[model samples]
Target chain A: MDALTDAELTILGLLVEHPRHGYELEHVIEERGVRNWTALGFSSIYYVLDKLAKRGLIEAIGPRTSAKSRVPFAATEAGREQCAAATREALAEPSPVRARVLVAMANSAALPDDEVAAGLAERRAALRG
Target chain B: MDALTDAELTILGLLVEHPRHGYELEHVIEERGVRNWTALGFSSIYYVLDKLAKRGLIEAIGPRTSAKSRVPFAATEAGREQCAAATREALAEPSPVRARVLVAMANSAALPDDEVAAGLAERRAALRG
Candidate 1:
């Protein structure tokens, strides 16, 4: 199987910790600022959960306590294995950092020096935020 | 118009320097170690050039000097303007660095502490290379 995407690894890793309903997953993701790191969206929580369920990497466990409470999902053995392997890969392999500014700087001859300097100033200000 | 992709930006940046055919552009990319930074592929050079030509950001200039000499492409006025704007945007914007390791660390509870430590050790060695 292919390596899990950041989103998949994240969701599976969370499920491996403990069974959680979709709402709980969303809450955890928000509390942890997961969105700031990965492109996982609020709407994608259920979608990702469904995908994991269909893949048999995760499965729903236990009955919902109430009609409003969604069924909780837990990682399967396969899911745990996959998540661990992915985590190991993530830890071992550093993804390339593509700095767009590097590319721009390389071709800065495309613009005047003053303009490039101004852009750098703007970038410094943006980064301060 | 949408911002240029990394491939688009890299190729256009090179073309903005001087008109070059596919072969020259390929040579420059290799000499500059551009692939180490961007996802631009050896084969995708022609494809990106074609896209730039179609968008009117770049255009064919002059005839092939020989059967071996490929048609060269150069950035047009519109192309220069766009490249400059994109360069400015690139310089002024700092894309978020999404470190997958951070996510893995956050959910490191998925694995044993020793395993996590081992993975990090492996990562350190990998980064040293």
Candidate 2:
């Protein structure tokens, strides 16, 4: 169903990999620079964890000082299933043509046909590469 | 700033084509099948129009009985500039990798190496094609 918002699915999906505390999740997000493409916020980590916990998609384990100074969260069976489904949805879904492209397409007259074709060719090449 | 959310940008970008009333916007949305990739709704059109107009990003033209009962809206100069900026942001901004792929990437061990390789190869082939 892709019921999870991009942030929620991202957090839960991360937990599916391993049990992680809030700080660990935050650390991984920063280390990977996931925030550049997605709007995952540092402050929203616990909020998502708590939300998932309430829905029984995730469970919080007791404090693990070894990793970080916070309780760790793990995906339950249902959570793993949810993660798989959501992940499939994410990957299978089309990467959207953003509005700027839509505007360009709508008013393509302003651009010479060759330039537009060239731009599209470059985009295709990048996707292929 | 891409301050416009996907819906807001979609709507404003539509107005960039021509002045359109509420029903026309709804009609265009349905005709385009945009709901597949984006979470646009029939109910949100006027709300978006009103919001854009309130921000002076759009101005309402006089009522046009021919199109529909609702008043038509047009983008103002500020609105056009905003559209251009926002549209640029939307296009330049990366279309994100959804959580599902991230999860699969993170937990690559569960899937057989060959399966992963095949999947990646298939994806690459699709992109190349």
Highest lDDT model number: 1
For each candidate, the alpha-carbon lDDT, in order, equals 0.81, 0.67
TM, every model: 0.59, 0.52
Could you give candidate 1's per-residue lDDT for residues A37-119 as a string of tens digits?
Answer: 66576666777888888899999896757432377899999998888888877777777555567878887887889999999
Relative to the true structure, candidate 1 reaches a TM of: 0.59
- Candidate 1: tens digits of C-alpha lDDT, residues B21-65: 888998999998886667566677887998899999998886747
How many backbone clashes does every candidate have?
0, 1
Which window of 10 residues has the lowest lDDT sum in candidate 2 chain B?
B91-100
Indicate which candidate wins on DockQ: 1
DockQ of 1: 0.35
Please identify model 1 stretches exceeding 4 Å from their true place.
Answer: A1-91, B62-69, B98-119
lDDT of 2 by residue, A1-129 (tens): 327766677788788888988988999988977764455656668778888988899997875454433888899999988776555544544344323345444434434567557666655666677
lDDT of 1 at A117: 92
True contacts kept of 2: 0.08
Prediction 2: B-chain TM-score: 0.67
- Tens-digit lDDT track of model 2 for B6-122: 667778777877888888888888897765445555666877887897788888897545443377888787877776655544443434533334544554544456756766666
